[model samples]
Target: MTGTPNTKIAFKNVRRVFGDGPSAFVALDHLNLDIFDGEFVTVVGPSGCGKSTALNIVAGLLGVSAGECRVDGDIVTGPGPDRGVIFQQYALFPWLTVRENVEFGLKLQGKEKSERRKIADHYIALVGLTDFANALPKMLSGGMKQRCAIARAYAVNPKVLLMDEPFGALDALTRVRMQDQLLETWSKERRTVMFITHDVDEAVYLANRVIVMAARPGRLQEIIDVNLPYPRNDELRLSPQFAEIRNKVWHAVYTRSGQQQPALEE
Candidate 1:
């Protein structure tokens, strides 16, 4: 499950503006980033610092107001099967059973019923949801629902996984478990991953490199290399190396947040 170590996605001088004229708000400004093939990168920033905005741009859900976003050298103009997105909200269809929810994308791809079922079953088992495969979304807990969401996103076998706070909604204990599950899944799948989160510790633990973003015209403030061994576990969380990286990320975030903004001219 080692990454290819080549550039898989790139953002060049990217900017995103919502609305226009007097009501215009620039969510991201001159954002530049490069995500390597099969690499796991986590982005952390203040609430309004465009953490999700950057992720959406890469997912092709939102258009950049300036510059360009490219996946494997191709400009990203729309959502494609090559990318899988998991949001904070589970977004599962209550009417669909767990297996059916995972098969949704494969079905749309015109995959045969038998083949779809095979793929669905494999990912469901991967997420430890085989026992609940026949269960409905309403019957599951918050953590189980998110597991379903992960299985659905991975069932398509996307090359790049875009996760926006996928574990944010779970309780403390469940969040830790989900984090472990995610690492195990990613290790086996070896896909390029970009995760967005507000938790500095989560960012440090999960990412190969952590991108710290500044507020206002959101932009990259710092990128901290994790330099930790793979097959990471909860024990790593208590390691001094983990604490070091976490503190570094926190310092960057704190310094940026405390900086005064320039005055606006009338």
Candidate 2:
């Protein structure tokens, strides 16, 4: 997708501080970012690094202390349907069927029952979970549950997708599979994605660009491009170019995350 001169998401000198007066804590300092349409940008850092906080701000779930965030040329203030968020916890309605879980947002927006069903079915198919549409969350696997969460996010036709470690709970094999599924969906949908992940390979594989955040106060440390072609699969992971990008992101995370940080083996 082509982008206009205007940025899809802009974070200009943004800062988020907690509390008031002497007891304040700065979560972000002079943070500036510009995410373009169809760009998959991954935010990575160690625990308590405020990485999730950045996603929260962009989602309009949290207010910024300073600076501003704009999505599609409009200044963000409160939560809107333009931005869809998928969190680590699937957050599905346990009582609802997988299809109903995906349709929840549409129902809230006053969509007709039949229309919601169609939309839900489309998304479930998109995530390759068509067979589980009638199943309940309690009956699905962890990865499948996350897929439902992703389907729910997409059913709304959001302008930007914000994911905060959405697959962190899955086992290693499942995490890798989910990552591939996400890449496939994104390649087809091309939605502006701002994702948070601690997995270096996942970030390198899925992101068009990687943004490394420092721990504690959380500030941008570096921005690196991932020129890996779309539809990255296990084969791409074994290639040299992928290894190079992976190394860069790994080192960026390692140091920024305060690890020495190991390099993504090149």
Candidate 3:
């Protein structure tokens, strides 16, 4: 499939399957999607809907069984520095301090020690982790660990961020704060982001558009545009507009195929 010039990530009739023959399971079926440059897109659906599967394809952690997954017009063959991935697990190195963790990718790229330090410091500060730069992962709270993971991803200067339930493990209050912090960072950095979440509120709160997927052999069930202005906060979350959009995403996610209702409108 042809993608527009502005498309940063494109999935053309993508399909992914596991196993073979009679017991084969299809995770994604003929999926087609486009994430534009500098746009924030959140994906939500029930378990086994391929939300993470799609993100994994973009991260080059998994291969598509059919069709293509492209990044910046190039076919995705493997992981590259241009794409950064964050999962629900912090995946931080227990032996490394926050600064070292953030600098890991830069070190792999053969950056000078001073240059890596500067970049890591900037991103660590960006994620509000300046105070813990020297602390190991064990010293951080769940939210703080996630923030460090995010900072580490950013320090690499990726063009796109593929996040799979990055805030899922945090407490309610912490999750809310992380959402705001992430939006603030996105506003300043403006990278293309495709975040996956099971929470409808979180999906609507953080995305330019929310992608809802069907169960099993996942395909796009609906795409809801979030027209609300950004710099989103707790005050915005309490607004009726936010609830409206949240409900739309909720219905799209929970409503089953045969019982699907008419789509909601603004």
Q: How close is candidate 2 to the true structure, as a TM-score?
A: 0.93
Top candidate when judged by lDDT against the true structure:
3
In model 2, residue pairs whose N, Cα or C atoms come closer than 3 Å (at least 3 residues apart or on different chains), thus clashing, are: 254-261
Worst 10 residues of 1 by lDDT: 257-266
Candidate 3 clash pair list: none
> Could you give candidate 2's per-residue lDDT for residues 150-195 as a string of tens digits?
9999999999999999988998899989999998898877799999
* Model 1 vs truth, CA RMSD: 5.2
Q: Write the per-residue lDDT of candidate 3 for residues 103-161, one digit (tens) a residue.
A: 99999999999999999999999989999999999999999999999999998999999
Cα-based TM-score, every candidate: 0.94, 0.93, 0.95
Best by TM-score: 3
Candidate 1 lDDT over residue span 30-62, tens digit each: 988888988899998777899999999989999
Model 2, position 121: C-alpha lDDT score = 96
In candidate 3 the C-alpha lDDT for residue 22 amounts to: 98
Using lDDT as the yardstick, the better of models 2 and 3 is 3
Question: Which of the two candidates, 1 or 3, achieves a greater TM-score against the reference?
Answer: 3
